[model samples]
Structure formats: C-alpha cells, structure tokens
Target chain A: MIRAQKIGKSFGPLRALSDVNFEISQGELIALLGANGAGKTTLIRILAALTRPSTGTAEVAGYELNREQQQVRKRIGVVSHQTLLYGEMSAQENLYFYGRMFRVPDLQSRIDELLGLMELKKRRHDLVRTFSRGMQQRLSLARAVLHQPNVLLLDEPFTGLDIHAEELLTRFIEKAVADQVTVLMTVHDLDYARDHAQRLLVLHKGRLAIDAAAAQTTRAQIVELIRE
Target chain B: MNSLQQIYTILHKDILLELRSKDIITTMLIFSLTVVVIFNFVFEPGSEEMATSAPGILWVAFAFASNLGLSRSFAREQENSNMQGLLLCPVDRSAVFTAKVAGNVLFIFLVELITLPVMVLFFDLHIGPVWLPLLGTLILGTLGFATVGTVFSAISANTRSREVMLPIMLFPVTVPIILAAIKSTSYLLAGRDMSQVWSWLRLLIAFDVIYFVVCFLLYEYVVEE
Candidate 1:
C-alpha cells in the first residue's frame, strides 16, 4: 500500500532522514521502532505528504507521494502525541469538525458510530478540555479513523494512556488490522510493539538497522540489533 | 468535493462556533469603541479639523481593532493543538488558509458593522451618500489586511515570541492597506469626486488580489512540518 525508496530529508546542516527505504502491504501493522531523533516522525510526515523529501520518491496508496499529495492524504490518517483536538469544543464537535473537513458523507451518523466505537458516547458532549488524558486520546483515535482511512500513522500513541486505556487501544488496533487497515506507528515501547505489530522496522542513526517479522525476532535479538 | 466546498465547510464551522461563543465580535466591538472614545477625548469632535479627519481616525481604529480580532482568529486552534487536526485532514492546506481568511473577513466585517454605527453616533457626523463607496473600500482593505495577517499569524503562531511577533511582522506588510484605506476614506468623507478616489480604491483591490494569491500559494509551505 506504501513504498518509499532511498528517501532522504535534510534541514540545512541536519540530516533528519537518509537513504531510507521501506514498503508496507495492505492490512499490515508495522511498528517503526527508534530512539529519540531516530527519524521516525520524519518518515511518517514524509509518508503522509506533510513534508517533501529532499531526494528520492515515495508512492502511497498508489499515488505518487510528492505529486499526488492530496490523494495520498485522503487515504492516510495520522495521530501524534498531541491529541490534535480543539479543547474548547466537545469530543463530538471535534469529530464533526474533521468530518466536515474531509467532507465525509453522512457526517453525523459517522460521528455517532465513531463515538460509540471509541467508548466516548457518554462524554461526547463535554468540552474536550474537561476530558482526562485517556479520554482525549481515545477521541483523537476516533477522529483519525472517522474517514475510514486506509493507512494509519501513529506517533507515540500510547505515551500517556493508563493501563485500561492501553488495553482498549490494543483491542482497537487489533480490530483495525482485522478490518484491513494498514497501520504504521512509531513507538519506544518494545513490549507494545512486540505484541501489537506484526512487522518491526528499527531505525539507527537515520538508517534502517533491522526489518523483520515480529515472530522471527526475540526480545533479546531485537535489543541486540538496537545495540548494534 | 472541490476545494471551495471544503473551505466553505470549515469556514461555516468556525462562524458557527464564534456565534455560539460570541468571543471575537464582542471583544472587537468593545475594543474599537474604547479606541474611538479615546480619540474623541484626545481631539475635540466638533472642531472642523477633527471632523475633516474623522474618516481617517475611524479606519485607523477599525484597522487596529481588527488586528486584535485577527490575532485571536486562530487562538482556538492554537490553544489545544487543533491546528494539527486541521492539517492532518485530507483537505488542501490552501483550503485552510482560505477558510481562515474567510472567517477573519466575516469577524472583522461584523465588528465593523457594529462599530460603525457607534462611531457615527459618538462623532455626531452625517454619513454622506459616499458612505456606500467608503464601505466598499473598507471591506476590500480589510480583506487585504486579513489575508496577509492570516499568513503571518500562522508563521508567528509557531515561533517563540508569537504575541509580539505577529504585530511586528503584520504591521509592516500592511502599511499599504492602511495608507490606502485612510486616503480613500478621507476622500469619500470629504465628498470629493469618486473619480479622484479611484486610484486608492484600485490600489486596495490590487493589494487584496496580490496578497490573497501569494498567501494562498505559500500557506502550504508555511504549515508543512
């Protein structure tokens, strides 16, 4: 569903991503594992068409990443550490706002379904500013999936969630994969990645260090790869 | 859907929110009235010279007060990282720019509508038939100001000194709009022939078109990560 070849991005003297190449097929849940400043977010931004590469080319959802960014954007959903929601508005309003932006058909009904799916129906009318971090995170998840985007890019999505929230998120991800949505997420939690991601791609110094199926690698081996 | 429809939907959402909260318009109206009152106290209203300069004073007040509105136009988005959600949507980034410009225009115009009657009442000045032409000039000038202001606001919103940065960056670029608005406003107020005022009006239109197109094109680059 997505292909990036020798993609590199640099900011003046700082190289954020270099010689990066990867691909993901439809319905695969891939974890982008990297330490701080390991170019994970940069790669996701590039794939999402939010940033243009300094070199090479990428194709997402069969559209050229740079040339057909709008189409690529339509097929991809993104969630970062920030909930990216309007705090002054209710969770329902936030989703409705994005639904209008994407011009989703039958926006109200879609918002209702998403609210129920994210278990936010009870708190849907309350201002998001009043929400717990966990509730806000769940709302963010619903917002991302509202358009039923084919590809999902999550950046540190589990950072602030409590255990219950994490479990709910895990179930959501499993269901998303079952529904045939391609998932690419950046994570620092190896255990979460080990359990959730079918494939793992590790980044070291802005380069791909390890790309393997989760089942093929043990925790010890994965740690050894990171050490190398 | 087309980009225009997408922009319209976003703009409609913002306007509905503003109507519910009454935040931008209320603040802008009160601020503008205070400015007019301050100007009145500083300059005697019945004096011939002061009456002659009333149009300039009115627009200057409107311009500055509208800047306050523009600053807060994106406040809701910036408050909780709502801008990221807007950016993540599939809509074109330029659509975001267009929607913001439209929203600012509406808010600024609403403020002007409310403030104009107040200005006329306090200043005790008769608005001539030329008031219609002057109103057109104000709208066009406001459009130009808001277009560039929206772009600069986004740029400054990400900076360390956003509060100070926005006015510093915006005021300099908006000199042309302010000058033209004041000039044309004074001409219409003085009841000068419309022909003579055409030059300033044309300049306002030209500035609006130029900045509108430039800002729309550059917005994608400004907001991209």
Candidate 2:
C-alpha cells in the first residue's frame, strides 16, 4: 500500500511538488502521467524514500516515509531513468550486489531466472558498460524486482526498452500485480498506461490534477487532463 | 542483512570493481608517484633539506592522491546514480558511509605503502625502530582523510563542479589530520623517541575518532536528496 498526504517539495525558488495527495490499495497498478518538470519523479522519489518531501508526510508499505525510511526502503523496489548499476561490474555481479544488500533469498537462482528472462544470461559475465542501452534497461528492471519488493516504484522505466522488452515488462507488471505487489510507475506512454494500469494519476505543475480508474477513462481524457 | 554484512558487501563490491577496472588504485598510485618524483626533483635527492622535507612530501603526495581517489570513488557512484541505489538499500546510512571510508582508506593506504619505500630509497631516509610508529601514523592519518573525504565526496558528487568542490570542502576540514600526520611522520622519520611523537599521535587519534563519529552520524543527512 502507498499513501501521500499533502506532500510538497521545493528546491530554493523552484517548487517541484506541491500539496500532492494520493493513495493506492495493495496490488493496485497505477500509472503516474506527467510532462517534463511536472513533479512525477519527485513524488516517486519521495515515496521511494530517496528524497524527503518538504511538507506533509507519506507512508509506503505501512512504514512512515520520514522516520521509518529504512523499513520503507526495504519494502520497495525502484527503477529510475538511470540504471543505478555499476558499469565496470558485470550484469550478474550488479544483481548479486543488490540482492545481498536486500538480503534476497536464493539470490543466485533469482538472478539466473531474471537474467534468463531479460535475455541476458549469455552476457551475464560481461561488464554492464559493454551492454547496449536496451540491455542495460532490461538489467535495471531485473535489478528492481530482484528483491521481490512489496511496493514497486518505476520512473520512466520504459525509456530505453525495446518493443519486446516493453512487452516483457508489461507481462512482468501484470504478474507482479496479480501476486499482490503494489505498483506505481511514471509513464509518458498514455496508451500503454491505459492498457496496462488499473488506475491513472495525472500531475500538472507540481500538483496532482487527476486520479481516475483507467478502465473508466479513455486515453483521450487522460491526454486532455495532462494538457490542462 | 546485518550492518557489518552490509558494510562488507559494499566494500567488497568497490574492491571488486576497482580490481576489475584498475581505475581508482592505478590512478592514485600513478598520481602519488608523480608527486613523489616531482618532489624528488624539486628538493634534490639525499640533501639535508630533502631529508627534512620527506614526510611533508610523502603526505602531500598521499593527500592529493587520496583526494583523487575519494573524488573518483563517489564519481563512480554518480555514473548510474548508484549512490541512490545504495541509499535505497535496507542497511543503515552509516553502513554506506563506513563502507566508503573503508574502501578509500584501503586504496590510499595501498598507495602510501608503495610510496613510502620509494621515498625512503630516493630521499635516503631511515625508518630505524620507528617504522611501526610511522606505519601507525600513516594508518591514523589515512583514516582521518577517508572519514572526512567520504562525507565531502558525497556532498560534492551532487554538485556541478564536483572535482573543484571536493578539495575545497575536504582540505580545510582535514587540516588537523594533515598537520598531525606530517608532524608525527617527521618525528618518526627523524628517529625521535616515541615519547616525542606521542602528542601528535594523540592529536591524530583524537581527530580521527572525532571525524569518524561525526561523519558517521551526519552521513544520513549528507546523502539525503
């Protein structure tokens, strides 16, 4: 579960997020849609415990964002545009490193399974810098879900994903949601968000402008909301 | 995972990455050696001035080289925003700080270990019975440098001109460490009695402990976004 109450964040004169409020029940897959500088990533970063909100408070997986950050972090998996991986280390090594940090059980098998799914098992030993953008994104995705986190926050996770990788991600999200893993992702692709997520959240100029069910709202409505 | 395990996992990862890439250690070794060689030429080898200046020269090399190493260590984390990834883990923030300090200390110490013999050979310096004390001084000084450097590296790694920001933030805070290290090293190099060097050693220990504790407590805030 995830909850945000009157959250705001500011950097000097610029306000990145303001009075944002939203909540998602367990296993609900929500898509956060916003244009550049619309505070989508800021909200996700707050929920991920990577950044503190300048005002109000949030709870992720029953842990308070401000005071219980370590507990919150333990329950969530995050993937940003950046791979958050070591290029000098191999793909497998990177996963192993995170797995150890998160104390993932049966980590080697989990790594092997994810690497196989990402179509990177053959290149598992090669340094991450040697991998292509799409491959690295795939590895990043693999790293995110490696711990089987209770809450998954993905920020533009599809940035460099190819068509097949996108499909794989969709299926993975479907499976994760089915398994009762709460998911909130920032996505630019309105069509994919409409097709995949159970709910949609639209942010405009540091505020949450729309919160609606995807099945009830068409992509056109979502587009108009984003435009507004 | 436990706190110590988390620390080791991070330290091991850094060491593995360094071993594979040979980036930080090699660069540090080369840069420090360059400093040593340049100082050799500047002060003239085997002269009384060179003998007197050996400890200062050695630490200057060690200091600047460790500066580079600390900058690169955090810069590596910035590459993929791996620092964020590290912060996202379940461990205490101090674990990350401790791991980074450990890695930096190891790399800088390795650089110093190699540079010392070269300094001795080039400057015609004697270790005598103070070799152990000299070694102790080097370890303490390196610890002080790393404890402070690791914190500054994280702060500066977020800034635009991180390379410039690191030294500006680091050297001033580490002034006591450098002064103490240089004095203790000079005393040890001169074959002074341990009693003569004890005061500087105490100061070095005091600073190292103080910096380590303060940095450990403040690291969580420093790495915050």
Candidate 3:
C-alpha cells in the first residue's frame, strides 16, 4: 500500500511538488500522468525514499518515508529513467549483486528466471555497457524485481524503448500485478496507460488534477484534463 | 544479508570492476610513480636534501594518487544512478562506507607498496632496517587518509565540478593525518628508535580513531538524500 499526506517539495527557487495527497490499495496498478517538470518523478523519488519531502509526509509498505527508510526500502522496487545497472559488470553480475544485496532466497535460480523472463539469458555474460538500450532497460527491470519486492515504482520506463521492448515491459508489469505487487508508474503514453493501468492519477502544476478509472476515462478527456 | 556480508559484497564488486577496467589502480599507480620520479629529478637523486625530503615526496604522491582513486570509485556509483540503487537496499548505510574505505585503502596501499622500493632506490635511502616500521606507518597513515577521504569524496561527488570540489573539501579535514604521516614517515626514514616517532605515531592513531568514528557515525547523513 502507498499513502501520501499533503506532500510538498521545493528546490531553492522552484516548487516541484506541493500539497499532493493520494492513496493506493494493495495490488492496484496506478499510472501517474504528467508532462515535464510536473513532479511525477519527484513523487516517485519521495515514495522510494531516494529524496525527502520538504513538507508533508509519505508512507510506503507501513513504514514512514523519513523515519524508517530502510524498512521502507526493503518493501519496494524502483526503476527510473536511470538504468541503475553498473556498466562494467555483466548482466548476470548486476542481478546477482542486487539479489545478494537484498538477501533474496535462492538468488542464483531467481536471477536465472528473471534473466530468462527479460529475454536476456543469451547476453547474460556480456557487460552492460555493450548492450543496447533495450537490453539495459530489461536488465534494469531484472535488477528491480530480483528481490520480489512488495511494491513497485517505475518512472517513465517506456520513454526510450522500442515498441517490442515496451510490450515486453508491459507483460512483465502485468505479471507482477497478478502476483499482487502494488504498482505505481509515471507515464506519458495515455494509450498504453489506458490499456494497462487500472487507475490513472494525473498531476498538473504539482497538484493532483485527476484521479479516475482508466477504462471509464477516455484518452481525449484525459488529454483535455491535462491541457487544463 | 548481514552487514559484514553486505560489506564484502560491495568490496568484491568494486574489486571485480577495477580488475576489469584497470581504471583506478592503473591510473593512480602511473600517476604516483611519475610524481616520485619527478620528485627525484627535482631534488636530485642521492642528494642529502632528497634523503630528508623523500618521505614528504612519498606522502604527497600518495595523496594526489588517492584523490584520483577516491573520485573514480564514487564516479562508478554515479553511473546509471548505481549509488541510489545501492542506497535503496535494506543494508546499513555504514556498510557502503566501510566497504568503500576498505577498497580505497587496498588500492592506495598497493600504490605505496610498489612506489616504496623505487622511492628508496631513486632517493638513495636505506630501507632495509626500517621496512617493518615503515610499513606500519604507511598502514596507519593510509587508514587515516581513507577514513576522512571517503566522507569528503561522497560530499564532493554530489556537487558540480566534483574534481575541483574533492581536494578542497578533503585537504582541510585531513590535515592532521597528512601532518602525522609526513612526520612519522620522516622519523622512520631517519633510522631512529621507534620511541623517537612515538608522539607522531600516537597522533596518527588518535586521528585515525577520531576520523574513523566520526565518518562511521556521520555516513548516514552523507549518503542520505
């Protein structure tokens, strides 16, 4: 589960997110929609405990963001625009390192399964830097899920992916949600979000401008809402 | 995993990466060796002045080379937000700090180990009688340097112009270590009894403990967002 109360964040001269509140129940697939500088990534960073909120509070997986960050971290997985994979290490090495770091059980088998799931088993021994962007993104996903975290947070995961890669990522997310992992992702592609996300949460000017069931809210209306 | 296990995992990862790239160790080794050779040219090999100054030159070379290694170590984490990824784990923050400190000490110590004999030969000093004491001084001094350097390296890594930021933040805080190392090293080189450098050794140990404890306690803040 995820909860935020009056979350506000600011850089010295710029306000990135302000007075935003939202909650998601277990296994809910929620997509956060916003344009550039709309605080989508900032919100996810706060949830991931990667950054502190200047004002208000956030709790993820029953742990307070600021007070119990380690516990919070234990329960969540994050995949951002940054791949977070070490280029110097091989794909399997990256997964092994994170799996061991998170104390995952039977890590070797789990890594193999994820590598196969990401279609990276063939390239598992190659260094990350030598891989294409799609391969890197897939490995990044493998790294995030290596621990089988209770919650998943992704920021613009489909940004640079080709159509095939995007579809692969979508299938993986669906599988994760089926396994009852609470999912929150930031997205620009309303069509993909409409088809894949059960709920849509939109942000504008650091405010929660829209929250609606994805199937009921047409893409045209969502676009108009974003424009407003 | 337990904190010690986590520490080994991190240290192992760094060592493997370094082995593959040969980036940090190779760069620091070449840079330090060049500096020592240059110092030989500057002070004139086998000169009496070079004998008195070799320890100072050694520490200076080690210090400059260390700065490069520290910068490169953290810079690897900066790649692809690997640092954030590491921080997101449930492990203690100090595990990351301790692992990095150990890795840096290993790399810098290797640099010194190779540089020392060349230093003795080029500077024309007898190291046979004092090798053990010299090794002890190098270990203590390197520990002091790595403890404080790790913290400053993290602080500077997050800033713009990180290359410029590292030395400025590092040098002031490490003054005690650098001073103690230079004095202790000089005394060791002079062929005096260990008691002659006791005061400097004590200072080095004291500073090493202080810096190590401070860095351990404060590392959470340094790495936190």
Candidate 2: tens digits of C-alpha lDDT, residues B186-210: 9888877788799999999999999
**lDDT (Cα, tens digit) per residue for candidate 3, span A151-180:** 999999987888778889989999999999
**TM, every model:** 0.94, 0.97, 0.96
Q: Mind giving the per-residue lDDT tens digits that candidate 1 earns over B1-225?
A: 588888887898788779768888888888888888887777676777677777878877787787778778877777667777777778878889989999999899888888778777877776768778978987998899899989888898888877788889988899999999888988887778888799999999999999999999999888885
* Residue A194, candidate 3: alpha-carbon lDDT: 90
Which TM-score does chain B of candidate 1 obtain? Answer: 0.95
RMSD of each: 2.0, 1.5, 1.7
Model 2 chain B: ten consecutive residues of lowest lDDT: B38-47
Put down candidate 1 lDDT per residue, A38-129, tens digits, no spaces.
Answer: 88999988987878999999988889998988888888888888898877778888888888777789999999898898888999889888
Predicted candidate 2 versus true structure: per-residue lDDT over A86-120, tens digit per residue: 99999999999999999999999999999998889
- Please rank every candidate by lDDT, starting with the best: 2, 3, 1
User: What DockQ does every candidate get?
Assistant: 0.60, 0.85, 0.77
Model 1 chain A lowest lDDT segment of ten: A219-228
lDDT of 2 at A218: 71
TM-score of model 2 (first chain only)? 0.95
- Worst-scoring 10-residue span by lDDT in model 2 chain A: A219-228
